[model samples]
Target chain A: MKTILESIALTKIFKTGKIEVTAVRDVSLKVPEGEFIAIMGPSGCGKSTLLHLLGGLATPTSGRVLVDGEEISSGKDAVRTDIRRRKIGFVFQRFNLLPTLSAQGNLEIAQEIHRNGSRDRQHVDEILNLLGLEKKTHHKPSELSGGEQQRLAIARAVINRPAILLADEPTGNLDTRNSMVVLKMIQELNRALSQTILMITHNPEAAGIANRLIEMRDGRIVSQQQEGEWNAAEDRMSL
Target chain B: MSSQLILSNVVSRPMRSLATALAVGVEVALILLLVGLSTGMIRENSKRMSGVGADIVLQPPNSSLVLAASTGAMSVKIADLVSGIEGVKAVAPVYLQLNTSGGLGLVWGIDQESFNGITQGFVYREGRGFQGPDDVIVDDIYADARELRLGEEITLMNRSFRIAGIVEHGKGSRLFIPLGTMQRLVGTPGQATMMMIKCHDKSDIPGVKAELEGRLKSYPIFDMSSFAAHLEEANRDFGPIKFFTRTVVFIATLIGFFIIFLSMYTAITERTHEIGILKSLGAPQGYISLLFLKEALVLGGLGFVLGLGLTFGGRFFFQLLMPTLQHQLPPEWLLYTGILALFSASLGALYPALRAARQDPIEALAYE
Candidate 1:
């Protein structure tokens, strides 16, 4: 499979006053086309930072990243923004829907940002239906339940049909039932729609749905296993 | 869809939006009211002066186009010279005094017969014109405003005069007294403020005016058309009032600017996480900036409508209280003020919008 996203020795160091902390150090990874990969680690092990670097949300300190063969890490802000707009969709753990906008409005804003003339009513409806959010189209984020809000967030992220979906703890705030529903929807997106997905999670059951699992420790990937070799025991051990 | 987002945001915070809009509305109302009063007086005075039906007008040298400021410096004998011109049919020499007691007003002193000749006579509602030295003729507006009946006494120049007649308005000054009495009272026995000349033929005015100008080289002279143009230009360049209006406009814009800035700044702070979500959804800086700008514009639009309502309401109430006061709303200033207010609001939102756009997505997402 073709490599859709690649990070070469990615490193990120944050500075506060005179002190510096390395959040991510010398991490290299590649994601193939149409693959669902999960990165599991402890809270401070830089899993989220790695996802941000790959998604063009943050610049690497001493490395490079490319999405779909285009270098995003070294590009100008506008160039990187354009690449992100065209190729990447992000789902956050908090289900960051604009509280003022309805579910449909949230989806429309993403399409508006992407500016694809393909944001026809039919396509928006299709995405809402696919996320089981068709009934809550007019509901604002505060009006929707946890599962529904997360589903709406997912619908907003993929409304423009981006090349890759980067989900950061998408089910972290949901109950077990809602978490399962959200994870199943994500898994369905990857299996049925052939979506390229990279998810970060602390739940082994959530990671079990991915085609591949990568475990991280101290800002570096410590293990990579295929779907058949995925081990919940090893994930807990690494933590 | 973007518009929906903007509308939702504005509607979401109704009180803040209303408060900001009220500030902008007051800004707009301030410009409208102040400018209206000044321009209204100018236009009203100009209209009445022109309606006196003079073919040619002559003012004392160095006198302003503002009739209220006219000084009785020119000799009444200048009207004699003016009457001698070939096309001259009649000449009315009028003395004027500015009254600044209870309110600003102008008192006109006119020779009744000559004044009546130029204006074809006032339409009298009661009594007669300047029947005695102590008699005063007031227009119907002044009569109604002062609630004075015919033969009622009104004080002028510290002397009481009986209201001899109340005539229809639109001729000249609201209060008129005999020229001899006005001249004597002011201690300028031979002087007049201005000379209103009527020509025998309408086509002879230019020739008559030229002749008068040639003869009285030291006086300021004009035909009616030129006189109107001069007043219009003077109105445009009227310094003190212009400065006052501009200062008010500047202050109003500043008020609008600060209010919008604070409103948008607070909104940005509150919506930090939403901005992060938008940025993550690949919204460019321009898009984010435009969102806030559109919201400000919406507020400005609402404020404009509110301002207009306040202005008209203010005018109605003011006129109800002071029946004699004339208030004119210039049509063009409405559009200019609206555009200026919106532009100011956009400028106000600029800093906050740019700050929102420049926010680090990661940091913003982590913002609690």
Candidate 2:
């Protein structure tokens, strides 16, 4: 399968006073087309930082990030922004949708940013229906429930048909039932649309749904296992 | 969507700020209009006074105040001597006399050609110019008030003269006659009451006055330039009133500026997060600035229209309320007001626009 996104020896360091803290240290990863992969790590393990680097939201201190075989991480701000806008879609835990915009309006803004003509109302309807947001199309963010708002954010992130979808703990703010609903929606998008997804989660159960799982500790990946192998490893660890 | 649509969206969100900006624009425009009107009136009056073609007025010694009052005139020989001086353009000896008709009239005796050139072709509204040597050009207002018409005879200073034409003067009414005719009528054939001198250049005034004064050291030569100086002195005497008017306008403009500034600042603060969203969505800083400029433009346009209506309505009311005061509309007033509205609106929006443009997309997004 063709690699939709690849990060080679990616390193990110942040400075606070005289101390330099490494967020992602020499991390290399590949995300192929039509695959659901999850990065699992403890708190402060740089899982979110890795996701941000892959989405072209932040520059890696040293390394290369390639999207569709094109080196996008080394370009100017405008070029990097264009690459992010055209190729990557992001969903955050907080559901960063504009409060003033309706669910439909939020999707329209994404479509506008991509310069897509005559907003794809049919596509929006399909997404809303798929995510069970048909009844919340005209509702503003404040009016929507937390789960509904998160689903709306997911709908907006995918509305532009980006090459890769990145989620940073998308289900972190939802209840157990809503988390299941959101997980099902993610599964449906990955299976039906064949969308390549890289999700960062601290929940092992959330990571179980992925075809592949990577475990990280202290800013470096410690192990990678296939879905069946990860289940077997979890069973052994439980024993 | 077009940039214009985006601008409309931003402006439409804050209706109260827009209204405040409009009010400021109108006040600035009104003040500008009043100043422009006053300046235009002064200029028009000056031009009309210059058209009378007199550089200096030769009056009797110690009779400066009396001559200004038009109560008496000077001797003619002094006028003849002034006319013989080099750089003297032309001199018309004039006499002022109270008629039996109970009206004040000037009996100016001049050569017809010289009179026409000096007056810039004074048209006779109803009759003809002086034809025979004994003919006179009657003042239009004096003729109208006294029911005097062309071909009628009028007795001035106890001498009869035919009224040949009715002349219009914006300032006041006066009668003109030929020098020979005036001598034939008044019986003062060799004497002139006042010398109206037209100098070659305005700069030659003081020198010519000194020379003429040397020749007639006992007489007083009051230059028309002195009348201009008197007008300037009158304006200086009214300095306090003019200063008060200016102070009022300045205070109003400052209030207008603050009103627009505070309103725009508040509106921008409300939209801080929205602006961040726009910037993160790929809107350039210039585009954001354009949004605020468009709002200012709308406010200025609306205010100009409202202010224009109010000014004209106010002028109409004044005309109706005080029938005695002349209240002609000066076009310069409208032009200046429109310009001032544009300037004030732009100035008022500038600082707020810079602040909005400088907002960080990251910080603004995190503001929530």
- True contacts preserved, each candidate? 0.85, 0.10
**Which residue pairs clash in candidate 1?**
none
lDDT of 1 by residue, B157-276 (tens): 888889999999999889999999999999999788889999999999889977877877878888887787788668757777678788889999999999999999999999998888
- Winning candidate number (DockQ): 1
Clashing pairs in 2: B56-B224, B74-B193
Please give, as one word, the docking class of candidate 1. Answer: medium
| DockQ of candidate 2 against the true complex | 0.13
For A44-117, candidate 2 gives per-residue lDDT tens digits of 99998888778766778999999878776783555566676677787878787776577888887777766633
Off by over 4 Å in 2: A116-137, A232-239, B1-16, B19-36, B39-364
Please give the TM-score that candidate 2 achieves against the real structure.
Answer: 0.59
Worst 10 residues of 2 chain A by lDDT: A230-239
The parts of candidate 1 lying over 4 Å away from their true place are: A116-118, A233-239, B157-160
